[model samples]
Target: MKSFYIKIKSFFHSIEDNIAFYPALLSFLGFNFAMLMLYLEDKGISAFVIEHAPPLVINNADTAKTLLSFLTGGIISIMVFSFSMVMVLLNQASSNFSPRVLPGLISKRNHQYVLGMYLATILYNTFTLVGINPKETDKYQLPGFSVLIGIALTVLCFFSFLYFIHSISKSIQVNSILEGIYSKAKTRMIRLIEKEKKESPSFPDTSDWKEYGSKETGYLQTFAAANLINICKENDLQLKIIPIPGAFVLKEIPIIKASKAIDKELVEEILSNFNFAQGEIVDDNYALAFKQITEIGIKAMSPGINDPGTAINTIDYLTELFAIRLQKNDDTIITNEDKSLIYINTINFSELMYQVMVSYRTYCKHDMTCVQKLFIMIKYLLLQQTNNDHYHNSLISEAKYLYDDATANVENEEDKRRIEQLYKSLPNKRE
Candidate 1:
């Protein structure tokens, strides 16, 4: 039952991440509201309201029909224009930023809500217009209140459209994107730190464990750690997960090791707790935020784009994220109430630093400004470092690599000398 609940939770999380979820939900609400209005009109509720309504309120079917018709056309145009702009923005983001960021942009709640509002207004107006009886003389069935509501919704949507434009403009800005990624990464790191600080039982030894291979191949989006821990506790098994979330695993590759051999059925059942998808989602896996930020920096420094300013801004945000990561623990362990059940592997600080810095060095090595920025970033990180000699050494190694790249690629003697000076000033340079 716990496993089933976890599956349900994961399913909802996936839906929440989908771009169309909110819009579809709002569209359904609009359709149902239109149906309810029609029912009210048939029951003479609209007729009674029309009789008592003020002169400004649309009481005649012909006027309401014309108004709804106009609104429908106007909203349809707005939807088309908004969708076109969204497509253009997406294209710009993909070319100038990173394609990985497209999901974050697409799943933006404000944009989705605005689009959904437009859809709701259109659907409501269309359905309300159909329910109007222009030729009925005995009892006019004009949905005046419904028409008024539609008009109000249209005005609301108009304002929402304006806000959407402003929001999209800001969303596509490079600095905004980098800050968003950094903020999310920092939040994830904080959560990890809090989790690590919690008291938990030590993991049992599993040196003689039997390894279980996964049946699928893709990015390990997420797994039910709590459920897995409970399962291990119930089965009297000690498990070690070999791959972290955001890792790519291959079919028949060992993903988990157990204290004892398990049957194929149990193996498949255990694998069911893991979710693998074709692409990475930053919300589920924080490490993907680092990857996305790195890609954005790379794209900014590319020959075709040649926007070193944006790359430098990205470095600033990454430097902040690395500072937060520096103070966090590297291990991931989960246990049951009183006993250790699972141990999972996660990317250590040094590896994450290497991955991000290497990508920056590979792309921005020729740009002296970026090279200098890298040295400064490393210097700031060095100050944030604890007594972890290994981490400090890693920072020093990264600095040397940045210096070497700048030496080989930077042509101007003055710029090279500046980078050399920056490298020389780094802590532990002699080591």
Candidate 2:
């Protein structure tokens, strides 16, 4: 039962970004609302409206039918146009910025709510229009109040369409995309820092533990840590998840190990809790955010694009994100009460810095603006307060590597002088 819940949660998380998710949800709500209006109509809501506020009710069947028909057509047009605009912006963003950003953009809840509003309004009006029957027109009939609500919903959708127009305009800009990535990644890093893991969890020697292989292939995007802990405690076992989130898992690859040789059935049950899918979300894995930002900067520095301003901006964002990351421990221990139940591997700070810096050194090394910015980025990380000298040492190493790369490739003397000066101003010297 727990394993099934894990798969269900992961499936929803994977599809939250689907274009139809919110729209489909709101459409169902709209259907229920229509039924509610039908009940109110049966309860003489239209007659009550006619008694208190005659002007607000729609008495004429022809007028109500015409208005509902017109609204349904108008809303369908608006929905189609709004979706097309989204596709165009998505395409433009993919081309200009990074394709990695589309998931973030697609998952914007505000936009989805607006789309859902459009869908809901359409469904509501359609249903209300269907109830305007000829045979029931003699008594307290006409579904007058329902027609009024439909009109109200149509007007609201128009306003929502206007908001969508204003929003999509600003969303396609480069700074918005960078900030979106930076914000989520920073939040993720803060979670790691805030998570309680004072004592490093010591895992039992896994040399004798039985290794379990993945049954399928995909990127291991997320895992159910709580479920893994529960399963371990219930079975009286200590387990080690071999790969971190965002790792590409292959079929038959050793993805986990158990303290004792567990049967293949239990192994499959445990593996079911891991979510393997495409796309990297910063919320699930903060490291992917760093990689995405670096890729954008590198792409900006490409000879064809040649936008050093964007490269420099991306570098500045990375610098701030790295500062947040500095406070996070590399420990990936999941504990239950005082007992440690699972060990998940995580990339250490030194290795993370090298991975980010190597790409900048390779792509942006030739450009003076990028070279100086990369140097300052490293220097800035050096000055941030942290208890870990190891993180500082990694910064120092990356800083020197950047300096050497500039010294060898940066031909301009003035640029070289500035880098050398920044290099000399390092908070800690590399011996």
Q: Which ten residues in a row have the lowest lDDT in candidate 1?
A: 136-145
Tens-place lDDT digits, model 1, residues 1-431 = 76799888976776665678888889999999999988887787766765776553576667778888998899889889999999999999998898989888888888899988988888899888887788864445567778888999999988898998899999999888887777777887888777767744577676778898999999888887767777776788778888888889999998999888878877887888888877777777778888898899899888898889888888888888888777776766776665667787788878999999999988888888888888999999888856466787889889988888879988888997898789889876754
User: Candidates' lDDT values, in order?
Assistant: 0.83, 0.86
What is the C-alpha lDDT profile of model 2 across 1-431, one tens digit per residue? 76668778887987787768988899999989998999889898999999899999888888889999999899999999999999999998888778988888988989999999998988899889888985565536989999989999999999999999999998888898899999988887877777744555566677878889999798887877777878898899998888877889899999998988888788987988888877767778899888888888888887778899999999999999899888877767777776888887788899999999999998877888888788788878888988678999888988888888878997889888988898998887775
What's the true lDDT of residue 26 in model 1? 92
State TM-scores per candidate. Answer: 0.92, 0.94
Q: Which ten residues in a row have the lowest lDDT in candidate 2?
A: 195-204
Q: What RMSD value applies to candidate 1?
A: 2.3
Q: Which has the greatest TM-score?
A: 2
